[model samples]
Every structure is written in C-alpha cells, then in structure tokens.
Target: MIEHQLIVSILLIVAICLLLMVSHRIKVAYPVMLVLGGIALSFVPGMPRLRIHPDVIFLVFLPPILYEAAAANSWKELWHWRRIIGSFAFIVVFITALVVGYIANTFIPGFSVALGFLIGGIVSPPDAVSAAAIMKFVKVPRRVSAILEGESLFNDASSLIIVKFALIAIGTGQFVWHQAAASFVWMVIGGAGVGVLLSYVIIKLYKWLPMDENIDTMFSIISPYLMYICAETVEASGVLSVVSGGLYFSYRRILIIGFSSRLRAENVWNFLIFLLNGLAFLFIGLDLPEIMAGLKADGVNLWTATAYGLLITGALVIIRMGAAFSAVFVTRFMSKFITVADSRSQGMAGPLVLGWTGMRGVVSLAAALAIPLYIPGTQTPFPERSMMLYITFVVITLTLVFQGLTLPVLLKWVKFPNYDDHLPPEETERIIRIGMAQASLDFLQRNNKCADVKRSALLNSLVTHWNEQLESEGLATLYDDELRKNYHNILNEQRLWLNKLNNENERVDEEIVRHFIHRIDLEEECLLKE
Candidate 1:
C-alpha cells in the first residue's frame, strides 16, 4: 500500500508535467483532459480507496492552494473590481444559498428547509483551483478578469461560513440564525485583526533573531497552517485567517524581511503550492470509485441521478450567466446611490461570454466527500447520500469537460484575447522614478549603513559605473527632478481623462486596452524575433 501510494504520487507529478506540456501545445485546459483520463482509469479494477476526513482535508490542501491563488493576484487587480468581488463574496453567495436551498427543499424531502440551505451553502463559492486553471483559457476583459480572480480569492470565507453553519445544524442538532450571522462577522473581523497583529509580530521577531534565507523559508511553510489551525480552534473560519495572514505577510515582504530571505520564502511556498494543487486534482480523480460505491449501495442508478444533475447544472448555468451578464444591470440600479463602480461599456464582459463558466474541480469533490456521514443520526446515513454524490459528480464532470473544452473555442470566435485595460501610465512612471532614485542613492545609502568611507566610495563608484552601463543599455531613463515633476503632471491629467472617459463611453476604454495589448504583442514579437 505504501509503495502504491508512493508510485501514485510519482506518477501524478510526471503525468501532470507531461500533460502541462501537451496542454500548452494543444491550447486547451488540461483539467478537462485530466478528468477525462481519470474517469477512464477509474473504470479499471483493483484501485485502493483513500479515506479522507474533513478536518484533515482543509489543513492538508486549503492553505497552500489558497495562498498560491491569492499570491498570484496583484493587490492592484484585486482592488480594481472590489465591487464585483463584494457582490459575489457577500451578496451572490447569500442569494445562491436561498435559491438553491429553496430548490433542494422542493425536490428532496425529509430534508429540512434549513438543511437544504446548508446544501446550498456547500455549493455556493466558485472553486479557486478551477477558476485559476480555467481563467487562463478564457479571454475575459480586464475588469471582468479582476472580478473573477478577486471573488475566487476571497469567497472561500463566505462558502466556509455556510458550511460551518450547516455542519453545526446537522452534527450538533443546533441551528441559530443570529449566532450564525454573528459567527460570519466575527470570522472576518477576527481573522483580519489577528492576521495584522501576527504579521507585525513576526516582523518584530525577525529583527531580534538571526534572520536568514532558510529561516524565512521555514516560516513560510509553517505560518499559513498555523494561522488556519488556530482560527479553527476558536470556531473562526480558518480559510479567512490563512488568506489574511498570507496576504499580510506577502504585502510586507520588503519591509519585514531581507531580500535574500524574501526570495527563499517565495520559492519554497511556490513549490509547496504546486504539490498541494497536484495532490488536490489527483485525489479528485482517484475518488470517483467512492462516489460510485455510494451510488450503487443506495440502489440509485447514474442515469436517473444524472437526469436531475443535468437540470440542476442548467440552474447553476442560468443563475451564474444571469448574474454575470446582468452585472451591469444590477450595478446600474445600485450605481445611483453608490456613486462609483467598474463598468464594461457595451455592458458586456466580452467575447460573447454570455454563459456561466462553471469549472468544478476538487473543492466540489471535497465538499461532497465531507458530506455528513450521520445526519443528526439515529445512525441512519443521510438519505439519498449516494444520489447526491452522483449528482455532484455529474455536475463536476459536465462542467470540467464541456465548459473547459469549449471556452477556448469561444475565445477564438470572439477574438477574446484581452489586451484591453492598459496599466496606469502614471503608476508605471512613479515606479520607474522610485527605482531610478534608489539607483542614484545606492552608494550613499550603503555608506550611511556601514559607516566606512573608503568602502562607501568604492561602492558609490561601482554604483555610478553600473548606472552608466544601464543608461547605455537604455534601461535607466534619468532620475532628474524636473523630469519627475512633468511626469507627475501628465499622470494627473491621464487620471482625470480616464475618469471622464469611463463616465461617458465605457467601450472606448476597450480601445485603450487593445492599444496597449497590441503594443505588448509588438514588443514580445520583437523580443522573440531578436
């Protein structure tokens, strides 16, 4: 068994790496193909079943996966569509819970209305792994990209809140509305509050310790799971705590750690996240047998449950498409009072992307596995457990296979290669100036730090030599004060213009983005040609 597990792990890495190459060559999402392969392999005999406990599940997978997803998102991108994120993370989740629960209650009886809501909650948030993977295949507009990425990054907390409440209602036989509401509030607030405190505390400690690259790397490995476990113990949402802590620490990389330490930490965490992501999808593939067994034992056939899943999937698609497409419609009504928001001018998110792109992966599978074994039990397993699993698997399979495969085709049809939404020129200018300023003061800063005039002179001379070399290479554009002032003024005008343009014709900004995209393409072409 141990050897088999080892071989499987080895095979998974090699298989995924090979698949990664193939996917790039083919220009399609690997997840679709991977699941297809899994489904085929699952039909073979003699595979060992893996046992997974819910608590162990999150600790093993969630933190690293969430960290990787969050770390990949620039803080700039996240803040861009803050409103869209709020809608999905806060409002849409609640609505989905209400609607899905209402539907679940109608179809499946002996299930309490509140219990149905718990099921709704389980299905609410989009899976980060799925979104992160599939987003690469789709050519969404910049603002839309920001919303999808940001919502996926933050919605784990909301999804978990629903799951937590559902588990409490089912396991402990206690369900309190005010308590659950308060629980949600406390999880967010407490997680953020503690995360901020811990980040600074870690920073302060680093000052006293013999901070080194290895130390930071080790700390990175430990911190996310530590925060997660601590929050879980307090009945707070561990996902929020882990994400908050990872973000707080990552954003403070420069201030709290040396350059060498930061790099070491970053590399180690990246490797860890890769492993977690691989294991997550692999398990999703391997766990098909369990779902099958559950179905067979319940005497529910796939054809029957699948019929229901098809309709349910349609419901999911309708809701999500209706939500994504009508985003502007909803935002406009709220825009009257809210006063500010991100808008796609055609009121379209581009590329005829009218339908909900539901790419279900491990999270849905994990949630299904975490399905309660005893529902407030007289020891009777949750009724129709097998049927529910079958339905969920069908949803995951259809989405991963269909949406995952066709998304690229849709992009090609719509010319959906988004280059719209140029990076703020002023922001770029500011960054350039700051970098130039740092280069200019390099030697002087070294002298002040080490207090060695002779060494400092050599360093300063070296810095000057380096700057001159870079200037020759066309890298340093001069750090003059006059240039800075003019650049700042131009930036201010650009911002004003941008605001006016956004206010008037939203679609025009798409042109601005396309311009940048074309420029980027040209630069890339030149580089490759060289």
Candidate 2:
C-alpha cells in the first residue's frame, strides 16, 4: 500500500509539472490550469480519489508559504501602503465575513449566523498565488502588487481567527463580544512577539555558531516551523508568527549569514515554494470528487449547494469592491489628521483591479475540510459540513478561474498611472553601481598607499576599471576573447594568492576572508554571465 501510494504521488507530481508547462505556453495562470487539470483528471475512469487532510495543509504547507511571501515583501513598500494593507487584511476581512455571514443566514434555510460566519471566515482571505500568477502576464503598478501581497500575508491570520471564534460559538452555543475582542488582540500581538523573539534567537545562533552555508540554509528552513508551532501552542496565530518571523529574518539576513548562503537559500526556496503551490492547486481540483461524494452521502442536492456557492461568491465580490473603493476615501480622510504617504486619489481603475483580484484557494478549502465530523464529545454530525465544503470549493474555483483569467483583460482595458515616484529601473541600477564603485575606490585608495609596487600596480588597475565604469554609466566594459582570457587568468591568480595568504596568516579572521572570496565569486559569476 505504501509503495502504491508513493507511485501515485510521483504520477501526480508529474501531472502538475505538465500542467504548469501548459499554463506557461497558453498564457494562463498555473494555479488555474492546475486546478482545472486536476478536475479533468478526476473524471478519468481509473483515477484515484485524493482527499486533502486539513492538518497536513495547516501544519506542513502554510508556515513556509507564509514565511516566504513575508520575506519577499519590501519593508519600505509595506510601510508606505500599511494603511490600505491593514484595512484590507483586517478590517475588510471582518466586514466581508460579517456580510457573508448575514447573506448565508438569510438565504439558506436553517443555517444560523454563526454557521454563516464560519463559511465567511473560510473564504474571506484572498490567496496571492493566483493574482500573482495572473499579474506576471500583465503590466501593473508596483504599489498594486505590494498592496495585494502585503494584504495576503496578514489577512490569513485574521480570517482564521474569525473561524476560530465562530467554531467556539457553534460548539459551546455562546458568543461574548468583549472576551473575543480581547482574545483577538492578544493573538495578534502575542503571535508577532513570539515570531520576533524566536527570530532573534535564530539570528544569534547563525552569528555565534561555526556553521557553513548548508547548515545556515537548513536552519532557515526550520525557523518558520519553529515559530509557527511555538505560537500556535500558546494559542496565538501561527500565520502571524510565520509572517513576522520571516520579515524579521529577511531584514537581518546580512547580519546573520554571508552572500553564499543567501544565494543557495534563494534557489532552494524558489523551488520549494513552486512545488508546494503547484501541489496545492492541483489538490484543490482532485479533492472535488471527494467533496461531491460527501454531499451525495449527506443527501444534499448538488445543484442547490452549487447555487449557494455561486451566491456567496457573488456577494464576496460585491463586498470587496465596495471595500476597495471605500478604502480610498478612508485614506483621504485620515491623511488630513496625520502623516500619510501618497494621499493623492488612486481613482477607479486601481480599486477595480484590486476588487476583481480576490481569488480564493487552498486556505479556504483546508479550513472547510477541517470542520469537525461531529460536535465535540458526541456522535451527532456537524451541521451543514459537507455543504460548506462544497460551497467553499465552488467559491475557490469560480474566483480563481474567472478572476484569474479576466485580470489580464482588465489590465489591458484600464490605464494605470505610474505609481512609482522613483527613477526608472535602469537609472536606479546605474546610480547604485556608480555609488558602490566610488565607495570601493575610496576604500582601496586609503588602504593601499603603504603597499609594495606590484600590489600598488594591481590596485591602480582596479581603480582604473572603476573609473571606466563610472565614465561608462555603469555598463560592463566591452571585452575581446583575449581580454576575457586575461581577465579570468588574473582572477585565478588572485584566488591562488588569497588561499595561500589564508593558510599562512594565523592573525586573519577566516569569516572575513571568506566574505571577500564570496565577493570575488560574485564578480566572476557576473563576468561569465556577460
């Protein structure tokens, strides 16, 4: 049975890869393609039924995914858009849940408000993966991407907290406003504090320990899980824990590890995140069969459940649109009272795009699947559990497919102003390179005055190279085959000399020497790439 399972897993991975390739070729988002492909695969005559375990998703998948997204975010950009992101991530999520709860309670016979809130919480947070995938094919302002990505990082924690409260109310048949509010605040603050504390400890470990890049990268991989589990064990938010920890680690990365580790970790993380996301979307599709089966077992009409899903999805979109536009007005009003960044009106295009990009995915599905099979300490079934799963699945599908596909068209139709006030990318790169070159030149000139003639000549040559780079506006120097050969030979000689010096010099710090070597390696890499 284990061998069979392994083979099946391998086949599914292969299928995901093929679908990803197809998505790229067809200019469709991979999440949409993978989910659609998985659904189609489900209809095959001999296809195995795949069921998603909620614990597996929550424990194994979420921490690293949240951490990666958090780490990738720019602190400056996040701060600049913090108001919008916070509103969307926290306030809008609550509003959407409440609205969804109300709609569900009103329309669905016998469904209580708490149950509606449960489903609302499940679907409130938008998954960044689908929107990001779609945005790759379109030209969007940087602020839009930053806002969406930032919102996604925090919103998961907020929505899950709502789910937690709703579950508590349903299970125990009580809801207290003040206690729940206080608990929510504690969860956010405590989770963030836990993450920051753990990250500091890990950073110290990286600095104090005698470890290589591989060991450092391994520690980084474990850090998120440590933060998440630790926070959740204390009844705090694991999602917030991972996000805060990731952000802290990213900010302190240079202090904790050298360049080689950063390079290796980036490659490793990119591949890991890709595999995880692909499997997640694919699983969403594959799980459809199991969800349908559950609905059938419960004697719920498939059409009726689907209609409910559609209605909920429609309501979600409307609520998000209203919230998105309302945010602009709110920001404007708040700017009058205090400091604000870009208080200028964003107009309809930006909000419309933001509103339309509310694609739901793995988190919602996982949360729905996690609903208890029966009430605590009893055999009585959880009310409307299967129907909730079916509806959540429907919402995820419609949003991902419809919104994901239509996003590119929306971008083409809407004209977004240049939201970035900074210099163009090329100009920015040129300025940064020139500044680095100047700094290097100054450092070398100050240190090399007392050096021998041979060393002085070599240092002078490097100084000239920097001067040439400055004059050429930071462009690489044109090189012939002979020049390239000689340049590489010179670099090889430097490596040999450095290695000999390291071996002979007991006074030298090996870490400092290694840092220099890493810089040389990067330079050589750039040259080779050119």
Candidate 3:
C-alpha cells in the first residue's frame, strides 16, 4: 500500500508538472488544468484510489492556505470592502446554504432538511485556492479582487460553522436554536481573540529570541498551526483563528522580521503553497471514481446521481448570484442615506463577475467525506452520505471546470478594470521608491550612521541621483544606472572567475561555486531592490 501510494504521488507530480507547462501555452488557469489532469489520469488502469482524510485537509492543508491568504491581503483594503465581503462571506453563505438546503429537501427523494443543509453547507463557500489560482490569469479591478479574495478567505468560517452545526443536528437528531446561535457568536469572537492573542505573544517572542533566518522562517510557518490548534482546542473556529493570526502577523511582518528572513520566508511560503494547491486540486479529480463507485454500490444510477448533482450545482450558483446582486442593490439604496460612496454603482459588471466566480474545490469534498460513517447510537450509516458525497463532487467539478474555464472570457468581455485605472503601478511604485530613498538618505545623514567618508559619499550620491531622475522624469528606478552597471560587471567577473577555477585550474569545489553564486544573486537582488 505504501509503495502504491508513493507511485501515485510521483505520477501525480509528473502529470501536474506537464500540465503546468501546457497551461501557459493554452492560457488556462493552472488549477483548472490540474483538475482536468487528475480526472484524465484517473481513467488509467490500476490507478490507486487517492483518499484524502477529512481531518488531514481541515487541519493540515487549511491553516497555511488560510494564513497566507489573510496575511497577503491588506487589512485596510479588506476593511474598505468590509460590507461587501460581509455580505458575501456571511450573508450570502447563509442564504445559499438555506436556499439549497430547502430546495434539496423539497425536490430530492427521501432527503431531509438536515441532509439538504449538510450538502448546502459543504458547497457554500467559494474555494480560495481556486479563486486565487484563476485570478493569476485574469485582470480585474483591485476592489473586485479584494472583495472576491476577502470573501473566499473569511467565508470558510461561516460555511464550516454551518456544516458543523448541521452535522451535529443530523448526528444527534437534536437542534437547539439558542444554543446553536450562541455557539456561533462565541466561535467568531473566541477565534478572533485567540488568534490576536497568539499573534501578539509570538511577535514578542520573535523579538526577544535570538533566532537565525531559518529558525524565524520555520516559526513563521508553524505559527499558523499553533493558532489553529489553540482555537480548535477552545471550541472556536480554527479557520478564523488562522485568518486573524495571519492578518496580524502579515501586517506587522516588516517591523519584526529582518530583510534576509523576509526574503527567504517569501520564497519558502510561495513554493509550499504551490505544491499544496496543486496536490489539492489533483486529489479532487482522483476522488471522482471512488465517489462514483459509492453511488453505484448504493443502487443509485449514475445518471440519476449526475442529474441530482447538476440540480444542486445549479441552485448553488443561482442563489449566490441573487445574493450578490441583491447585496449590491441594497447597499446602493442605503448609501444615499448614509452619505457613503457606492463603488458598485459604476456598473453591473463587478457584481456579475463576483457572482460567477463561485468555484468550489477540495473543501467541499473533504467536508462531505468527513461525515461520519456510522451513527452514534446505531450501526446505521450516516443518512444520505453517499448521495451527499456525489453531489459535492458534482458541484466541485461543475464550478471548477465550467466557471473556471470561462472566467477569462468573461473578464475580457466586461473589460475588467485594472488596479491602476486611476494611476499605473509603475508610477505608484516610482513615487514610493522616491519617498523611501529620500527617507533613508535623511535618516543616515541625520544619525551619522555612515561614518566612513566613502559610505557618506555614496549616500550623498544616491540622493543626488534620485533627485536628478525625479526632476527629469518624475521617476526613480530601483538602481542608479552606473551603480547597476558596476554591480553587473562585478557579478560577471565573479562568475567567470568561478568557471575558470572549476574548468582550468580545477581548484574549486562545486559546492563552493554554488555558494558564491547564491551570495552574488542575493547581492544583485538587493541592488535591484534599491
């Protein structure tokens, strides 16, 4: 079994890599390709069934993903769209879950409201993994991106909470309205509080402890897990715990982390996220055959299950669209009375895009599979578990494939606004660079930090270089032309010398050459950042 698992893992990685190569040529979203690739590979003979334990995904896969998304976002920007994100994250999730649940209960045979809601909750929140992956290939306004990303980040808590309670209602056959309601409030408050507290303590510890860049980066990775575990231990929402912790730490990263740690952490986190996301989407595809088999064993016809899945998927999309448009309309109507600016009033394109971007991915599958196998008091299996899993799989497939594929076309049709609709990014970045350069020069001069004559002269030279460029073109690139040229010459010289030592003199170890090359690359990167 272990060897089979290893082979499957290796095969999946190779397939993902090949698909990624083709993704750029086809101009399709990478995650979508992974999904298709996974689906395609599953048809191969003797392919092992890849099972993702629900606890593993919820505990292991979720924390870092949530943390990275939360940390990457601008807290201020997220706050600006607080109302819209709130509507989509909390209100839309509840509305969609209830609507889908009620529809499933009414239309589907032998399915109760609890079962309907269980399916509803599983599919409610849009997967950030899918959304982020898709966003890489499309251009949308910053506000639109923020709202979608924010909705994905925060809505998991809302949907997961609903699923948790719905599962309880199903498992125990008891629904305590007041207790459930109170539980929701406590989870939200406690999760956020715990996350914030943990972040504070970690930041202080990071400051007091004498740790290297590697240790600091490791701590950065582990902090999210710690926050998540602490929240779950206290019966709070672990999703929210990860988000809050990620947000706090991300906002304060510049103040607490040194340059080397920040750079290394960024690279490390990026690679990890890519690998995790690829595996997740691939696993979604791999689960298809097993879910189909489950449906068959239960005497459910394939066509019947597919039709049911389609109906639920349709309901999910329609309900989400209605909620999104209604939220925009209501917010616009209320803005008049509140003296607030209506950003969505520009047009319906933004709302339309938001409504259509609801792609479900691994989370729904994990939740569906996580449903208990047997009832607590009886040997009977959980009600509608097979159907639920099948339906969840259908929703994930439909959204990820159909919506994911067409999103780029939709963006082009709508003429999606760029972040720099008002001002281009280069201009903004240049302005920021000028201010930063001026501030650095002022501080160095004021504090007499550059005691050496050459260092002080270099600082003066940089100030003059920036001032000249700003006066001429209102632009100051990261490096002065001469300084950049000099660095390149030095880098070229070092590389050539290393090659000579290795090839001609045979005097240098390969490890030493690689080490020196890495050091030079870092130095060059710093110059580029200047």
Task: Supply every candidate's count of residue pairs whose N, Cα or C atoms clash at under 3 angstroms.
Answer: 2, 0, 0
Which pairs clash inside model 3?
none
Off by over 4 Å in 3: 339-344, 416-423, 449-457, 469-530
Report lDDT (CA) for all predictions: 0.62, 0.83, 0.77
Q: Work out the TM-score per prediction.
A: 0.79, 0.89, 0.87
**CA lDDT of 498 in candidate 2?**
44
**Residue-level lDDT tens digits of model 3 in 145-259:** 7788888888889989999999889878989999999999999999999999999999999889898889989998998899999999999999999999898887676457665
| Winner of 1 and 3 under lDDT | 3
Residue pairs with clashing backbones, model 2: none
Which predicted model would earn the best lDDT?
A: 2
Per residue, candidate 1 scores C-alpha lDDT tens digits across 245-282 of 76666555534555455445666777786666666665
Clashing pairs in 1: 420-513, 421-513
For residues 220-270, write the lDDT of model 2, one tens digit per residue.
Answer: 889999999999999999999999999888766644566567777878999
Better of 1 and 2 by TM-score: 2
